[model samples]
Target chain A: AQSVTQLDSHVSVSEGTPVLLRCNYSSSYSPSLFWYVQHPNKGLQLLLKYTSAATLVKGINGFEAEFKKSETSFHLTKPSAHMSDAAEYFCVVSDLTGGANNLFFGTGTRLTVIP
Target chain B: GAGVSQSPSNKVTEKGKDVELRCDPISGHTALYWYRQRLGQGLEFLIYFQGNSAPDKSGLPSDRFSAERTGESVSTLTIQRTQQEDSAVYLCASRPGGGDNQPQHFGDGTRLSIL
Candidate 1:
């Protein structure tokens, strides 16, 4: 079984400050991880993906995430918070052991960028 | 290029009514998926279709929920005798193939509100 746990249900950061959203995963096989952002009333946009490739993955906007196998973690981060970054962030894991390739998503972290 | 498209951006209906949601995936994509996102919750995988192969329906919550895909093009998800619990944002996604590395592209989703 594969699952992802987002450490924070909500996170608030002041503008110009750094931001971090934590996530942990449990999977039987080597997993493919992804971070997706969903703005209000909008579709989910893929921020970045780690497919057994680079451990440090950079994404759109100024967001990025690092895949840590030993820690069983993949935390999203940004150098500075922006108002437009306020949205729901989801950490997802792809399970291919069954050959179905279905995604398991976290409960999501709601980011609030404060001015 | 267009991303995945979903129909009926918003749907409000009385309980017990049947509703159909549509999805148009990106051209040439061979994999389509259906997911549900309840208020304050993460996405729940509903179903998956891949290139004429039997769909992976294990994620479907109930028998009332069903989906069909036409070749690699459009797909429809139908809910029979919908209940209040069925009220949520139904999201449709598609990827180029079943590879774990391929990130799923999502639509804005159909916000279903059961009255």
Candidate 2:
């Protein structure tokens, strides 16, 4: 079984400041990880994914995440937070060998960017 | 459509009523998935379909929740005898073909309010 956990329920940051959202996972096999962002009343959009190619993955809107195997972590980070970056972010995991092709999502972290 | 499309952007129904949510995957994409997001909660996988293979319904919460995908294009999620607890935002996603590491594109989703 594979599962993801978002450590923070909410994270508030001022515009122009750095942002971080913590996530951890447990998987029996090597896992495929992803970070998705959802704006209010909008569809979930893929921010980035880690499929074993790179440990440091960059995504759109200046977002990035580093996959640390030893820590079982894939925390999302932004060098500078923007007001428009306020949204709900989910960390997802999928098994590497399962034919199910389904993803397991975390509870999510709501980012609040202050102007 | 350039992206996944979902119908009935918003639906309000009373308890014991049945609801059907529809999803149209992107043209040429062969994988479809259904997920439910409750208020302040993470997304829960409902089902997945790939090509002509039988859907994986392992994540469905109950027998009342069911889904069907015609080939790899259109999919419908049906809830029989919906309850207040069934209120949620139903999300549909699709990817080009099927693989372990493919990133899924999502629709805006249908907000179902069961009263």
Candidate 3:
């Protein structure tokens, strides 16, 4: 079994400033981690994924996340935030050995960018 | 369209009524998924279908919800005795071939409102 936890429900940032969204995960076996973003009234868009390939995974929209096994964390970061980056972010985890490839999603963290 | 498409973009139904939402996955994609997003929440996995394999419905919230896929093409989700809690955006996604390497493409989603 696997589960995901997003540390925050809301994160406010200023345009051009750095952004961070924290996540923690637990899995009985090797796990796959992912981040997705959703705009108002829209479907989710994949941001990045970590499947034991690389610790640092870069995604579209200048977003990146690092997987740290020791800390059981995969935190998303952006060096600079853009107004368009304002959206809801989710941290997801899945068990590679699980019967289905369905992902377990966190409650989500809403990103509000103040220009 | 080059992406997944969902029909009846918006629907409003009275409580206890039945509603059917449709999903048209990308042409040639073999894996299709359905998810639910409540207001201010993250995406919740509902079900997934891969080829002719039996679908994974563990994530479905209740027995009131059911889905079907015909010949690797269209899918319809039926919610019987709909409750106010069932009101949310239902999203559909599809991926080419199988496995997790190729990211899933998503439809805009169907906004279901129970009044």
Candidate 4:
């Protein structure tokens, strides 16, 4: 079985400050990880993905995440938070155990940016 | 359309009624997925369709939850005897087939409310 756990349910950061959202996963196979953002009344948008090529993955809107196999962590980070970054973030892992390539998602982290 | 599209952006129905949600995937995409999102929870995988192969229905919560996809184009999810717990945002996603690394493109989703 594959599962993901988001460490924070809610995170608040001020504009121009750094942002970090932590996630951990348990997968039987080499995992493909992804980070997606969903704004209010909007569909989910992909932020970044890690598919074993690189440990550090850069995504759109100045966001990035590092896949740390040793720590079983894939933490999303942004050097400077923007007001537009306020949204719900989810960590996902691909599951191939039952011969079905489905996704297992975390509970999600709600980001609140303060002006 | 250039992206995945879902119909009936919002639907409110009485308990015990059956509701159907539709999805139109991007052209040339062969893989489609359905997910459910409760008020503040993460996305729950409902079903998946990849080309003409048997769909991975492992994620469907119960027998009442059913879905169908025609070829590689449109898909429909039907919920029978809708209950209050079934009230959630039904999201649809699609991606090009042949690989598991591709990020799934999402739709705006349909908000279903059961009264």
Candidate 5:
């Protein structure tokens, strides 16, 4: 069984402040984690992924995430938030257990940026 | 590489009607996936096709949802007797073979609204 949890449904941050979006997962095997960002009327864009590679993975737009095995967490973070970062973010875990093409998504966290 | 493409970007259907969504994946991608995202919900897995084998329909909401893939190219998802609750954004994604970093290339999605 595989599941992903997005601890926060919404996060509000002022522009230029640090951004944090938490996610936790439960998987019996080594998990494949992913972060995806979706803007209104846009398709999902892959932010980052962790597949037993380096614990910390960097993605586009200066966003990054750390895969902590012990904590079962893969939280996404950015040194600073930009107005363009206001969107819905999803954390996903593959159901493959070790295979491919099956993803279990988090409920999603909506990020709001204030000027 | 050209991204995945889905047609009929918007669909409005009356209850009890049927609708079909089309998807064309990238040239060399062998894994295709279907997912549903409601207004306030995360993505819900629908089905997956790997190569020319039988599709994994485990995540399908119900038998009313069915999908087919011809060769490794295009796929179609069919919804019979659509219900108001079935309205959502339908997404199609494709991955390169079974690689771990095979990021899922997504289509813009079809917005289906049931009236």
Candidate 6:
């Protein structure tokens, strides 16, 4: 079984301020993790992914996430929040065992960037 | 051509009506996935297809939801007896092959409204 949990349902930050969205996961096998963003009326976009590569992964629009194996967390962060960064963020996990294509998604965190 | 494409960007249907959503994956990609996102919620995995093998439908909420894929190309999701709770954005994504690390490309999705 594989699952992910987004600790916060919502996160608010001022433009130019730092932001952080927390996530955790549970998988029986070596897991592949991903972060995705979706703006209103748009499709989901891949932000970044972790597949046992580098623990620290950088993503588009100046976003980044760190995979903490000990903590079972892959939290997204940014140095500055832009108005465009205000969107829904999901943390997903996929178990690599047997090459399954299923991706378990977190409930998501709605980021609100105030200008 | 450059990315995944979905048809009928939006659909409005009455209760008990059936709806079909189409998706064209990136050329040569052999892995396709379907997910649903309800208003103000995170994405829910529905199904996945890898090559010509049997699809994994474990995530589908109910029997009313069904999907089909032809070879490694186009795919369709059909919802029968649509209910108000079925109103959501249906997302289609495709990944190159079944590699555990391959990233999935997503389409803008079809927004379905049930009345």
**Quick one: best lDDT, which candidate?**
1
Could you tell me which residue pairs clash in candidate 3? none
Best TM-score among the predictions, by candidate number = 1
- Select the stronger candidate by lDDT from 1 and 2: 1
Show the lowest summed lDDT stretch of 10 residues, model 4 chain B: B95-104
Classify candidate 5 by CAPRI docking class.
medium
Q: Write the per-residue lDDT of candidate 6 for residues B1-115, one digit (tens) a residue.
A: 5899998899999999999999999999999999998888777889999998999998899999999998899999999999999999999999987776777899999999999
The TM-score measured for candidate 3 stands at 0.92
DockQ of each: 0.75, 0.75, 0.58, 0.69, 0.57, 0.69
Worst 10 residues of 4 chain A by lDDT: A94-103
For candidate 2, list the clashing residue pairs, or say none: none
Model 3 ranges off by over 4 Å: none
Native contact recovery (fnat) for each candidate is 0.75, 0.80, 0.48, 0.66, 0.48, 0.64
Is model 3 an incorrect, acceptable, medium or high docking prediction? medium
Q: By DockQ thresholds, what CAPRI class is model 4?
A: medium
* Residue B64 accuracy (lDDT) in model 2: 99
lDDT of 6 by residue, A1-115 (tens): 6778899999999999999999999988878889999889888899999999899999898999999988999999999889999999988887766446556789989999999
Q: What is the C-alpha RMSD of each candidate to the true structure, in Å?
A: 1.2, 1.5, 1.8, 1.5, 1.6, 1.5
Model 5, global lDDT: 0.90
Candidate 6 error regions (>4 Å) = none
Write model 3 residue lDDT over B1-115, tens digit each, in one string. 6789998999999999999999999999998999998887777889999989899998899999999999799999999999999999999999885554466788999999999
Chain A TM-score for candidate 1 is 0.96
Interface RMSD of each: 1.3, 1.4, 2.1, 1.5, 2.3, 1.5
- Please report the TM-score between candidate 5 and the true structure: 0.94
Model 2: residues >4 Å from true position, as ranges? A98-101
Q: For candidate 1, lDDT tens digit of each residue in B45-86?
A: 899999989999988999999999988999999999999999
